[model samples]
Target: MRIKYKMVLLILLPMLVVIGAIAAIVFVQEKQLAAQQTLVLEESLLESKRAEIMDYVSLARTSIDLLYSSGRNDEATKEQVKAILRTMNFGQDGYFFVYDTQGLCLVHPRQTELEGRQMWDKRDPTGFPVIQKLIEAAQQGGGFQRYLWIKPTSGKETDKLAYAVLLDRWGWMMGTGIYLDDVAAAKAKISQESDKRIHGVMRSLAVTAVLAILIVVACAVAVNLSEQRSADAKLTAMARRVVTSQEDERTRIARELHDGISQQLVSTKYQIELAQFQLPESDENRAAQQALEKGLDGLGDTIAEIRRISHDLRSSLLDNLGLPAALGQLANDVAAHTGLEVRVDVSRCQHKLPDTPAITLFRIAQEALTNIVKHAAARQVDLLLSSDRRSVALTITDDGRGFAPEAETYAQSGGIGLRNMRERAELEGGSLHIVSQPGHTVLLATLPLSEAG
Candidate 1:
């Protein structure tokens, strides 16, 4: 596992996860909406049927009322009631019949067996519950109600929605009901859509996962032999042992010269300057003495420059004082060395974030400011590190003669410096932004705060 491919995995896996999650969410929402639309339309149609039935019953009641009042037990009233019963086929397993409290039938269209034979002791087996409800509503006033149904003929069950009203004082109930079969049919359609969406999303996810793996493998191949080396290219692999070993070596070398030869040379330079300053100046040795004095002066200057160089190369206090102290030292040193005024506000971040994230941020700051010092010719810099309960952001700004970042040189020239910074941020699920104008360049990095323990 070379680091580049691992870094590639670190980059692409999260993308796949995000795309998958979004697709799943969209699929679910779309199915729910489709199902909802089906149910709404179904209920609306059933309600229309219910209204038509109620109107039919109203006309039947009016027709029967006219028959009773006009003294005609005639064919016109019976024929009109029969017309109303025909519209109820939409309620699949439902029916309609009209009877009086005197145990007599006014109209029972399904009662070719009982149009004239009813004595009103009969109760509807399938329609009684709904009829009883309508009777109660008519007895009370007008209102909305519900009933469940199972038709003996169709053998299908339904949840019914209906509205009821009083027809008259003749024990007649006029009302209409909506069938829920349409609701079930719509649910079936939604179920099919859900199956389709799941299949599609899973197929996409599978292809994406497979593609990511292949891309990594291919990238690992392309990344190989990137630098030609005597028919045997030496490469750094992205494995645990190699990166860790490299870091250990860097820390060791940085510590040695900082603590060892630098201090010794500084002490030697001090002694030579002291001896030269104390020598006599009146002898023929005066010119030689003056030369020794100047030599000592040059040695002192050389010593100072070497120490400065060593300090810049590595900070011994980084390992000793940890990241926060190291960052403070870096800021101070940059201001002192570059002759730029720097204001660093890091109150919300007195401790390191997650160890790896902290290291990444530190390195980013180091590289960015180093570039500013070397090339920006900036005068003032502002570094802000603010943390909340969730995330922390580090921003570095320099008031320098900023250049156009739109040009390809901004990244291509820096080679892996910018690329490495980007990789660090992406690996940790964060982002980086760069903005530059005539006299200002700002670089910002953000990551979670509480990862360092």
Candidate 2:
């Protein structure tokens, strides 16, 4: 994958994992809560069932009292008891039964046919004191109890919750309860809801991670394209400047030869012919003397002009004497042209350097000094030429009315050609640095003699 994708994965993968874990935890807890709430709801339902059963049995005892007072405690009362027993599912999550003061069942919801069916000197469903205890409580004051391990049915196991109250007259005790089945249903529902919510959270996290990855890739692409375009534009501009400089150099050479040297040579040839015509052919001594003198004078002037042109075209001293001699000539030219004091320190450059490095250094110095003469308009210039086994460094500092290099519109134009000097150094795999401010300008060029020519 590209680095952008890698980075996004690095950042988002961990976050997604963490979110997934948190979601799982939340889901588990939510499931637990649902289960607990279901249990509570079931318990509440069982309690309501207990209350209804207790009320019916207590009302039956009141009915017994009413029957005795009205003298009808016979056939009609038994039918009423049978009807009450029919209302109970003896072993659902709920159960109910009834017993008299003699510890015998008057009505059993399940085995109602055995109406007198209990041995109730007995324990409650939880194995504690039951009918007899409630009767004593009714004789003393009144209170209730809650405990565990209650077994109300025989020949089978019954985990029961029973509430009992004392029978007042003929003696009776009653209670009702439901098993814990309802609690389990509530727990399952909570688990399902929690699972759904956690999965939802994980899905959301995954989406966010995907979005982050896409954003990173987009930014990386934008930066890469922008940088590529910028580099291409710089290269194009540099190429154009190189071509322009080459054409300017060719035109300059042509103009100098045509305007300065060709016309001078033509004029001199005409003058020599005129002198020949003026000389008398018969006076051999005077003619020979004047002709020889005129020829020597004209030739000397022409030779001087030719040498100047040659230097302008390419420093002849570079071919004849070496880099130092060429720089010495440059210093002389600068002093002559600008009326500025020019100084050169060539002691460090005595040991010859690689040819390309020497040429690049020379061109940089030549361009800098020329610019100082043409544009600096100051009194003094310092040129320091130095070299080592690895590289050569030349520094040209001018005490001049300096111009801002970055602001110099004419650097690539006619006024000062510093840009050309920079390109020359760069072409030779070197750098030229310029530090200029008001009243001071320093140009330092370092070319690697060990590497570049």
lDDT tens digits, residue span 215-302, model 1: 6667643322332462222222333333455456556545554566446556755755565576565665465465555655655665
Clashing residue pairs found in predicted model 2: 35-187, 125-150, 125-151, 126-149, 126-150, 356-453
| Residue-level lDDT for 348 in candidate 1 | 70
- Model 2 vs. true fold: TM: 0.38
Per-residue C-alpha lDDT of model 2 across residues 221-332, encoded as one tens digit per residue? 3222463586567666766565456445544654665566556555655655565566566653454545446554655565466556556656757656778888888898
Per-candidate total of colliding backbone pairs: 5, 6
Where model 1 places Cα greater than 4 Å from the true spot, the runs are 1-247, 353-355, 388-391, 401-406, 414-416, 427-429, 449-452
TM-score to native of every candidate shown: 0.42, 0.38
What are the Cα lDDT values of the candidates? 0.61, 0.61
